[model samples]
Structure formats: structure tokens, C-alpha cells
Target: MTKTLFTGVLSLLIASCSQQDDRICEAVAKAPNTISECVHREGYLLADAEGSIRDVATAVVEKCRNHIIQQLLSKPENGPSLEVYATAIEDNAVEEAIRRVTEARSGNCKKPE
Candidate 1:
């Protein structure tokens, strides 16, 4: 019984230390800024046009539209600002990711600025 418990603990420790193939990480790695770029990457390949768009439980948009509305909301808005969206990646790395992603997302967000 002791041996079994020890093995289980060791397994848990190993799993905890292992690097996770996180989607956000992969997405950032593949394309730091834009959604289109990330979609072409391995994990994000599944992110291609999905369901329609919904507005706070309102009408829906065209079929197979980009379902990641959160991405759009990230644009620099003069309206109510929010800082709730953040990731755990290092600042430099995250900056790189944002640079890449934003480049691709160009013009799709808040008017060119």
C-alpha cells in the first residue's frame, strides 16, 4: 500500500512539472497577434469559422462566422475599458505574442490607430 501511494505521488509530481501543450501558448507561438494566423497553426487549426455570432442572447449572425468574439472585444476601445483578460506568460514573451497577433489582426479591430 505504501509503495502504491508513493508511486501515485511521484506520478502526480511528474505530471505537475511537465510542460502543458496549452492552446494559448501554441496560439501565441504560432501567431502572436491575429486570429487568422493562429488558426493555421496546429491546435488552432480547429478554430476556423464555427457557429454564428450572438449578442448577449440576441440574434445570430451568418453561419460559420468566427466564434471567438472575445478576440474582437480586445481591440482598443474608447468605451468601457477592462483589464480582466490576461495570461500568465512572461511580459516579454507576452509582448511578443501580442505583437504577432495584433499585426495579423490589423484593421479588424478598432479603427486603425
Candidate 2:
């Protein structure tokens, strides 16, 4: 009984540590200033596409989409079949990224002088 309890506790500890290591979204979400700066840099590279803020935003999100999906999949509590939620997750992630970039550009994602 003691051995079984120790194994369970150890498993939980390992799982929690792994989840923390894989939490890319959590890290990004926590660093608003960093996200703003990254978006600004990416947007500057695409500055030639004037009047297409959405396109620039989409490109930035696409750059990070794979990492986002990988982070989502790493969560032990997520569904077993990522394929089932892939479309919805992609759409939601893109929409949210665009919204955030747009908001930041208006407020904080300024070109550094």
C-alpha cells in the first residue's frame, strides 16, 4: 500500500512538472509586453502590405500556431484525439491572435523610435 501511494504521488509530481514545461500559451499570455514587442517586430517585416493588418496578424499567429497546438496537446487533461478539435482550435486561436494583435497595435505595439 505504501509503495502504491508513493508511486501515485511521484506520477502526479512528474505530470505537473511536464505540464509546466510545456505551457507555452501560459507563458505568452502572462507576458503582454513581450507579446506586443514580438507582434511589432513581425508587423514591421510585413509593413509593405499596407492596409492589411489582418494579414500581418494572421502571419504572426501562423508562425506560432504549431507551438500553440503542441502546448495544447501536451496537457494531460485534453481530449485524446487532437484531430477532432483541431479545426475549432485553429479557428479560435487565429481569431484570438488577430484580436489581440489588433488591440496591441492600437495601444502598445508601436514602432520603436
What local distance difference test score does each model get? 0.33, 0.52
Tens digits of per-residue lDDT, candidate 2, 58-86, equal 78767655555565666455565666566
Q: 47, model 1: CA deviation in Å? A: 26
Q: Model 1, 1-113: lDDT tens per residue?
A: 99999999999977754543333233234332443333223122222124221121111111112423445455456643344332211232333333433332321221111
Error of 1 at 15 (Å): 3.1
Q: Candidate 2, clashing residue pairs? A: none
The best candidate by lDDT is 2
Return the lDDT, model 1, position 64: 12
Candidate 2 lowest-lDDT run of ten: 20-29
